[model samples]
Target: MVDVFLEFMLGPMRAIGDYYFEHQMLFNAIVIGGALYKLASGKKRHEREAENCN
Candidate 1:
């Protein structure tokens, strides 16, 4: 049933939400660090590709 499927999906999501609520600062730091890391790596990759094209 749809209820069963929703419970299965939402159960883990609820746990994650609870954890984030309890550890808001840690979670925010992790998210921001991950975004920065991706941005830095993407910039380096673009620079390398540009150098190769030239």
Candidate 2:
């Protein structure tokens, strides 16, 4: 079941994955940057609530 699926899916996926893996720096940079941006922006909502106490 899984083997059949992988065999079919992985063919095309591997081609794209190969490109992604070859250029992993771009993927990693985007993921890390997006995570950092999400973390920073998430803090603003909490900070806004805190300021509302004033």
Candidate 3:
């Protein structure tokens, strides 16, 4: 049932999936770094706001 809906786009989806898997390690590292950077910067901004309020 689901295969019927998914069959038409599977080729391109598989290609994209393959490319990501080929560079999966690098892709994961970049994603983790960006997430950590965002977390640190947001914490800093929140700290500054709290300090300003006090």
Candidate 4:
């Protein structure tokens, strides 16, 4: 039944939502730091490639 499927899906989703709410700051910090690291590394890689081309 749809109810059964919804319960099954929502149960795990609810748990994940609760966990995110409880550790929002930690998650935000991790996401932001990861994004910054990727951007910085990508810029450096492009610069290196440009130097090699020249």
Candidate 5:
């Protein structure tokens, strides 16, 4: 029962898992870049709002 399910899923999951580990650094860079972009954009938006109020 469980063995059958595990075996069936493992085929597809194994390929995805392998690619993740292989390009792990690229993944890390993408995550970090997104975070930085969000931070910079938020700061700019705050400044614009403050200018409009004043």
Candidate 6:
């Protein structure tokens, strides 16, 4: 499912992130920030749809 796909994608991505995180904190911050942004955006969209139904 989606989890499996994310795992596949993030596995290598995490390795790359870790590799770069050692040399550059800003890159790590950006990666983490992007993931947080996506999570928040998805949550906000779901909440908006729920509010519309109510």
Cα displacement (Å) at residue 21, model 5: 0.4
Distance (Å) between predicted and true CA of 14, model 2? 1.4
Candidate 2, run of 10 with poorest lDDT: 9-18
* Candidate 3 C-alpha lDDT tens digits along 1-54: 866555576855876866888999999999999999999999999999999999
Candidate 4 residue spans exceeding 4 A from truth: 1-9
Against the reference, the lDDT scores of all candidates come to: 0.88, 0.87, 0.88, 0.90, 0.90, 0.84
| Candidates in order: C-alpha RMSD to true structure | 5.2, 3.6, 3.5, 4.1, 3.5, 11.1
lDDT of 6 by residue, 1-54 (tens): 976776788986776656775878777788899999999999999999999999
Which 10 consecutive positions of candidate 4 have the poorest summed lDDT? 3-12
**Alpha carbon deviation, residue 36, candidate 1 (Å):** 0.4
Candidate 6: where is the Cα deviation over 4 Å? 1-22
Clashing pairs in 5: none
User: For every model shown, what is its TM-score relative to the native structure?
Assistant: 0.65, 0.72, 0.75, 0.75, 0.75, 0.52
Error of 5 at 40 (Å): 0.7
- Stretches off by above 4 angstroms in model 1 are 1-16
